[model samples]
Target: MTGPGNPHGGDAGEKSAPAPKKGKRELWKLIPGFAISAFFLWRTIKSIHYDDLRSLHVVQPVWIGVMIAFLLGSYTLRIYRWWFMLRRSGAAGFGVCSRVLLTSFAANNVLPFRIGDFLRVFTYAGDLNASSSTILSTVILERLLDIFTLLAFLVALLLGAAHALPPVVVRGHELNVLHFAEPVLVLCAVGLILLLFGAPLLQRVVESVVRRLPAGARTEKLQRWALLLFDAVLKLSFAGRVLLLVSSIAIWLCEGMIFVSLSRMLAIAVLPRGPWLAVALSNLGFLIPSSPGAIGVYESFCKAAMTSQGAAPGISGIYGILVHVVVFFSVTIAGGVAFLAHRMARGAASRPLRADLADLPVEMPADLPPGISS
Candidate 1:
């Protein structure tokens, strides 16, 4: 994670640093992100009881190793999941997918504004010569899938466990955050279901509009892109859909192990309701926009969850920071390695910036717009 000249431990000449304007643009997008992170981070920090921070030393060393293993496993599955989506988009090969995914992950964790996401589109669009629209669609789909899965986890942990949230009394009134989450989850669940089920209808509506509109390149292209996204959304077969579900569940399981183990590592007793609730809460925090790698939002939600479970503020504070560091550094290092591997394999005669899509059978639809097939 050094400077751009050798981010992945490359030769100093591999690439120069990003230009000044580029850096500024990245920073500019992050203004809101950092502001949000700072607010939440300050809130969590103010709550910490410094005296109890000593509790961190008692965390089991063994769980630390377990947490690492789970994180690795989770990342592996994440690569596979992306590979899976790319294949559906007429791209294959796990090697390429892993490089883009890990490198993008490193970028997101290190840089600002979630710019890493565009790396997925760039790499695949260049290498596979597939529609960028399609690749971007899958990316959005992947996120929605993750969100839905996390929501499921939240719902399950809420219903299946007692003391899911610690009660708080404010001027003799009782409040628990979990109560708020329940309705939100229910509404979100309904919305997601509708989105999935309504894709075809939405697709038809867009297509109809596309047919009627007087064609201009930009407008027509945008409409077609929308059609393509809806098409991708509609096209996940039952098996592919199942795979997404299983992979999402597995990834979070790995994350939950990390969360629970790290809490143990910090020697905080999170039981009964356990780490699932903590995991759920922290992930919910991530759904909100924040600084790179969700720095403040993540810790705030985690500390909130732990404190509600009666963990000391000192324990929660240290646990949050340490866990974030573990993940942030681990993935960044792995991404660097992946970048190096990609460079080594490709060497000087790397693949073209754009390549033919001969691997998958693709046909222009007959009912498509005038310019596409004509």
Candidate 2:
């Protein structure tokens, strides 16, 4: 609630001062991230032979337009998913939620560590007067649901392509089957088991264990917060579950469509089902800790996936680069515009925060921990 470093009583002496050395260290941290991004950009450029650019001239403007449309649709669906999650938690409508999502996406593209996701939570909580903790809990649940859905889709893809894939892909499928599937299945099973039986189990465990502690106001408050968390978990009801499933499916479908449209634009008639595999694999690659936008990791995975599927190295590299550029620019521009609009609206509609801070609490305790520190 009160930030970890913020001290009690809100006095100047209680506040922590910024260290000059820490600022220098923070600046130094950016060096590696920027270097990683630069290295990837160079790799991507080197992979592109001039001769291949001449060949790519055949890609039509009309197909490119279609690809853009699919990407736009994907962004829209992402907003819709976030909106649905917020609605389940009693937040604002889709319009406000979409703007927040756009700003968040913009931040994620520009900032490191996917901070935009948490930013969306902050923005919505501020705008709607909802508990940031509740909204963030929904966000976490949304992500877990998305992962489960992606795993389901990956498994389905592997099974569908079992006979059609080449030996290497088949072997990859086997590895996925043996290595990834078991853990995923076990996790899903455990989550389900917990969801169904967690309430009574937790109640009994807490009553038996926590009752032994000194009975006081803090203990009562702890119990209250635990119940609130349990209630949040319970809010994942039938309708909420259905919405998560539907939205996850819709979002991935949009993504897959974008890939297919890109392939069409490139006039690659036989996309070989590998691009879908590549999409899933590329997402996994981006999960690794790295610089903002996962520049190197994303391109590397895309190139590897395409090359492994027998695509020309040059073509695959160019395609990956183009896809990244298109998606990045599209989201960033849209998000930036939306963020500016939101900022302008807030500025025009209300006085500066410093003016309002006199009336409102300087340190507004959050229902949950602050996310990403803005």
Candidate 3:
């Protein structure tokens, strides 16, 4: 039920798997993922043109290749952005972070119940010999930054796309996407403002409160991690902040181009705002509590976006499947490779140690950079 050598031994088997009762509970949690994915996939397939699917090879291989290139570039930028943050938090090397990033993505892609997130935290903690608390804080920060960036893009898209969005009337209510999105947009906007203007004061307040507490192990640990989170935020240079936002937006934009590429290949009309909206909306699918990769959620949102842009339902459905396949395989392949290489390298390095020495615990370092303790 477990992997060969346990790096997340301290996680009480949560990393590799859950206990039977917990596992059953997690399986129950998969109901929504399965239902949503099954329903949307069924709907999508029902709309697919059998003849068009048969001739799916009509698209140019070159554009597909270009999409892959952009995907790689986008991932590179994302990893580099993470590296910047990791370094700020006292992580030492880019190599370890790179492998951890890919492995985490791969795990998330393959596993259920979002176990990959735990795997990601444990993996990073193991690689850096850092505490899970500190690494988890960084991971949380990464996701927050990512969400903020995506919300910004969505807000911008919704505002500019008011005219282009297809009409949706449900239960005799003329539903406006912009109106629905406004609340979330306002929230994100307010959060952005606070991060820009009030983070320092908040950090100071947190630091004072945490420092005044007793210095026991738990309190010390909590104090260290709390301060690390704020300090990392404070240490981000203006240029680094720009890089985070720009790289995030650029990643989504590059991904959006896949829709355009597919459209061009399929000889469909999905331009102007279709690809962008599809990209934004489809990504929002990940926020849904669905199966790994948010299968149904992504396809449904994307197909809707494409259909809104005058694309045939058949083509849009097929296009969504194609895009999902391409992205899934690409990330899995890359992540798999990185993960295996890291494991093999670690094995080789450790195998050389004397048998008695190898079993000894390697304590986490005491001298972490300021505002952090392992």
Candidate 4:
């Protein structure tokens, strides 16, 4: 639970000093992501034309409100999903969970490497006096649910198409969506199979490795943490798993509606399926390491998806920027506000997070994993 790099654990008053060389190494690592972001950002900007500004003159304002509504709805569902998954962990209620969730997302927007997830788990665990590993398990499961659902969506979109979808052109190269999707689909299938069926084998493998290692505290902790995460999928009840899947689909659909509303507002002509494709591709694009908030990567993916479906390049570029702006500011502002409110409610006595790895259990929860009701 300790703030990332601190192994022995420390409190608010005592902080670990990061090694300069390690810091430099981390900074060096970020350069590639920054370069990638800059390149894609340039590509996105280059795809736009000043003449496209003329489209702004006829923009519809009503869809803006609709987009905001659906965007909020998406976040609401996300909070519910997380809360449902961790409610039994002695964590706080929906309101507290919602604030933590948004604050974490806001952190991800501004900070590199999705550090917000760590913040969410550690901070909430500290507050609840519970096991960070258990909370972490829920997070791992949430991610798997999201990945599975997104891949399922891409497959549905491909199969549901009336005709063959056009290849996406990137830097003069035409790439079929299937080419990208098929491999991902296979990977997800293999991963799901391993998770659902191969946990025992994996546990045996880990045990064998651990048996050969020197006996030590670090070794035991590492084994426990690894197994906890690996077993996350199997921890959930059958019904709880079903609910998570359904909610994930609903969450993405809400986001898709946001894109649909954006297309409507921008008055960009798109195929009936265009908005969904844009939503799927743009979000999946986040997987690529890029700048905070996925800056250039998002716009590039959205523009590509829109353009591939017959929208004008200029209009697609505009739409991409517009949608990103809406999505980014909405979460950032909301998270900022939520973080402030939480701090204010706690008063001035609140201290920096003190992560105690001792809070992590050596065994998984015996009860139904957080989401499922007994």
Scored by TM-score, the top model is 4
Worst lDDT window (10 residues) for model 1? 356-365
Where in model 3 is the C-alpha error above 4 Å? 1-19, 168-171, 202-231, 348-374
Q: Model 2: per-residue lDDT, tens digit, 320-357?
A: 77777777788889888876777687787755423432
Per-candidate Cα lDDT values, in order, are 0.69, 0.63, 0.69, 0.75
lDDT of 3 by residue, 1-374 (tens): 23223333566555445345544664676787889788877877888877867755645667767776777877777678677776765775877777778777876888765555666554356576555556666665677767777777777877887845665799987888778777888988777555645667766776788778887776666665556556556667777766666676787777777766766666666666777777777877888777788887788888888888777888788888887887888887888898777668778564432342223223322224333432
Q: What's the distance in Å from true for residue 111, model 2?
A: 1.6
lDDT of 4 at 8: 45
Q: Rank the candidates by TM-score, best first.
A: 4, 3, 1, 2
C-alpha TM-score for every candidate = 0.75, 0.74, 0.78, 0.80
Better of 2 and 3 by TM-score: 3
Output the worst ten-in-a-row residue range by lDDT, candidate 2.
Answer: 356-365
Best by lDDT: 4
For model 3 the TM-score comes to: 0.78
1 against 3, candidate with superior TM-score: 3
What is the lDDT for 331 in model 2? 84
lDDT at 211, model 4: 86
Candidate 1 C-alpha lDDT tens digits along 275-317 = 6666777877877988888988888887777776677766676
lDDT score, candidate 4, position 105: 92
lDDT of 3 at 196: 41
